[model samples]
Target: MIWIFIFFMNIGIDIRTLMDARYSGVSLYTLELVQALCRYGSKNNYRLFCNAFRSRDGRPPRFDYPNVSVTDTKYPNKLLNYGYFKIGKRPKLDRLLKTDVFFMPHINFVAFSRGARYVVTVHDLSFLRYPYFFTLRQNLWHRALNVKKLLQHAAAVIAVSEHTKRDVIELCRIPEKKVHVIYSGINERYHPLSAESSEARRVRSAYALPERFMLYLGNIEPRKNIESIIEAYSLYRKKNPQSDVKLVIAGSSAWKHGVVHAVARASGFFADIHFLDYVAEADKTALYSLAELFVFPSFYEGFGFPPLEAAACGTPVITSNVAALPEIAGGFALLIDPHNVAGLSEAINEVLNDKNLQQNMRERGLNHEQKFSWEKCAREVVKVFENLNSIY
Candidate 1:
């Protein structure tokens, strides 16, 4: 008779990032991954840890899974993080939570028992690769966390892409065997929506968006290279004066965002450019569907979501060739050099004038998007936990 061994363990998840009123890419990933984990890994017990020290009403979103429970505290984050950092694994997070494994969906200050193992998901190493892109305070915060040390000690590191896995191994010097590459899934909400739909019309009217505009949705920060999009759009307009296509720059502003606005105002096509500040999640699909094409000229990314999300919504995507952009959107979307303004302008013009190409991209994107799903990611993640638990 063949013998098979099966075991179950308690998994602790630090969910401090989810408290944001407006979730970032990482926050959304954590929320989706956690929900998927509960669904796919129902055999394992889950303990979600969140610290919201000052607000009595503060709580993470409620989950209806019997296998999932929460362990939260109202302790001030600054104090708790500092204590965790200084105390050097004194009060193990796993020990306190009474869990066998702990997982950080994103890198943050953490402590754990010496023998207890935990997994950490690394979405990107942008802060490390392009330190100047972040503020002094941000850099200080990263340094305070000693990110390299944290990764070194992690039982396993979950990289969002092969590019990110390579970065973890080379930059942080983590062993290749210690890192796992698991792609993030496209939310099911991002699919084709007709422009004539009531929701689409409402979003268009709400944002005062032009019908034939190309979109650039992401944090308006220098690292994202928003100016390149503006410059390229201006060039495209000047070259093709009869074209009535407009530019829509959405998403909330971040550090040094004033410069992006300044660039937009200085553009010759400034009148044609619209800044739809902080597009709501519910409106994103409409915004993508209304766009003629989605342009993301970011200089770097470990794994970009907007391009994939835009593509999944049946929108043609034109993203930079650098970083994980090509890795994720290569076969399905047009790629251009991030630093080449004229090239980017030409790319925009090429796509805008080619209806057949646009249709092809839309079809390909929908097909490519099918390859990634949260269920797959969660299953692989659970296997990581199982392997680590088995070793321990």
Candidate 2:
């Protein structure tokens, strides 16, 4: 039997990481990886190591399996502020040597851990390739440096998309064969809703969602290209004055509210735009189902999730053709360049005006959604754990 220990950036009672977790893809990836490991750990022994960022929050998230054991620094809140440097040495990897594999969901400190083999998931190289996307202060996290060093030593790496895999190979200089492209899976919570259910109506009442709305789901970061998206929406509304299509932006608002507000208020189409900052997870499905079309024209993504989730719910998608969007959306989406506001507006108009095209994309999207599965992702990851024996 093989033993594995999974390392996440942070986990535990406080949920501080959870607040900003959605903005970081690794947060969700870490959660899903643990769930996958828990499901398969019965056949292959496994345990988990997570940063208890807070000591007394609540029960740590788990999959009702006893094989997963969580270890914290015991004083995570203090360590969080000071980081590993001030917190003294981290939990010793040497103690985990009995385990055959050390799996890191995000790059972090590495302990050779006696004879344990290593595997890591590189969510993206955003920091290395595009540090300007983040604030100057954030671009210099000590842990970020540590994760990079750890990656160089890992036996293999898992990239959520080929785009990210390429980024890793080019930016980190990791070997191409060592990188596996395993996509993230959409939550079962996201799907087309039945008309009989009050799901859409319930969400509308809660979020004050207007009828016939265009949706943009994700953070309000500059990298998400919200300014460009709003510019395109403004143009779309100008050409079609009688259009009742409201442009709804949903998800966590980033550090710069002024920039986001400026983009929204400057819109001549303000009356037709809506922003629901930080929606509840439970309400996401209703929101996706109610949208007229889902537009995710992000500048870049490791593996764009909204378009895939929208396609899963049978919503027509208009997304950037760049990076992982094409790979993740497969052939189910209407692709447009993120920088091309006119192209985005045209794609939006075509989907809204042409019912036949929308229906075609809806069917293709449903088929595309079936191509990804968390179970398959779990099996593939387990293969990495099993292969650690060869490295040893």
Candidate 3:
């Protein structure tokens, strides 16, 4: 008789992305995925690692679990990045974590040894696809990272969507067999709130949101197609002068946002457009639940969170048909061309006025939201790690 031993691996997790104070899509994925992993992969030892020269808190986040530990250093990021680029593979990150395998929720400046086994998550190749959409500094940052060379050495590449996986296989020339499509999940905290609920009423009062308003929440940047949304909303307002629908824009500002501000000022309906800047986490679901509609018209995305998130809150969504939007939101929300201002304006008018459509979308969205969760994402991620573990 043969006796087989079940192997449990020491998995190193890169928490460098979570060190930033800003709450971005990458940070959300990194933090949530790791939290879920700790819950589900109880047998596997996890080492959360980071490198920061200077931080306001001057400490890496520690987990309260026997299976998890934090191994970090106070080193200048710039110097370490340059050293990784110049020194070939002298400084391996896996050695520092001392794990059987390492996983990066998102790619950044990194170095590895000749035999280092690591899996990397690639969010999108928008920088490569739409280079002109980014600023010079952003482009330079992508170039310096040498994404192509890094992916070539990675043990596996996890894409947030099938659309991104194809981009990796074709653009980076990586084998299709090596790339995995693993989506980021909508938080369970995002759920439908009663309109009469105290929390909902508080969010409305805090934001000064009128009862009838549509929402466009995301980074204020060129790639997000905010210009066209403003133009469409302006035209819509011109058409429906008697309507009381306001547009609430909330999110952090990215690069070249002056153009968006200029367009908003010139729209002649600037007073009706409210920019809430950063929103508090507690108020997010309430705001979504209170909104008449949610609009996300980005030109491209590896995977979108807001559309599904809005749906989870029982709000209707109108998003673009291009890129992963169709794949992600086509079944639940109305799809519009990101560039067609007239069409978009019409879409907004149709959705705002059509209660039956809203009801249909709301039901579909709630059902769709159940398809993704942090537990599901983490389970899939651990399976990938186990495959690598079996080799060692």
Top-TM-score structure, candidate number = 1
Worst lDDT window (10 residues) for model 1? 51-60
- Model 2 ranges off by over 4 Å: 1-24, 53-59, 77-83, 86-88, 94-98, 109-116, 142-144
lDDT of 1 by residue, 1-392 (tens): 99988678899998888877777899889999999999999999999988775433334677789999887767657778777666643346888889888999999877776777889999999888889999999999888878899999999999999989988998899999999999998789998889999999999899888868999999888889999999999999988999889999998889988998899889978889998778777889889988989999899999999998999999999998988989999979899999999999999999999999999999999999988899999999999999998787
Please give the distance, in angstroms, between residue 369's alpha carbon in candidate 2 and its true position after superposition.
0.7
**Superposition-based RMSD of candidate 3 using all C-alpha atoms, in angstroms:** 2.0
Model 1: pairs clashing at backbone N, Cα or C within 3 Å: 52-74, 53-74, 53-75
lDDT of each: 0.89, 0.74, 0.87
TM-score of each: 0.96, 0.89, 0.95
Name the lDDT value of residue 229 in candidate 2.
Answer: 78
Residue 14 error for model 1, in Å?
0.8
Task: Residues 1-392, candidate 2: write the lDDT tens digits.
Answer: 99997632111111223223343556666676668666754565555554554433333554466555555444443454455466545445536324556677776544454444567887777777777788876676633466556676777899998899999888878888888888777677778986346987888888998878999988888888888778888888888888889999987878575697798898877777888988766777888888889999888888887798888888999998888888888589999999999999888888898999989998999899888777788778877766655445
Give the alpha carbon lDDT tens digit for every residue of 22-125 in model 3: 67888888888998999998889999887776655533455788999987677657777776667754257788778888998887887777789999999999
Give the top-scoring candidate (lDDT): 1
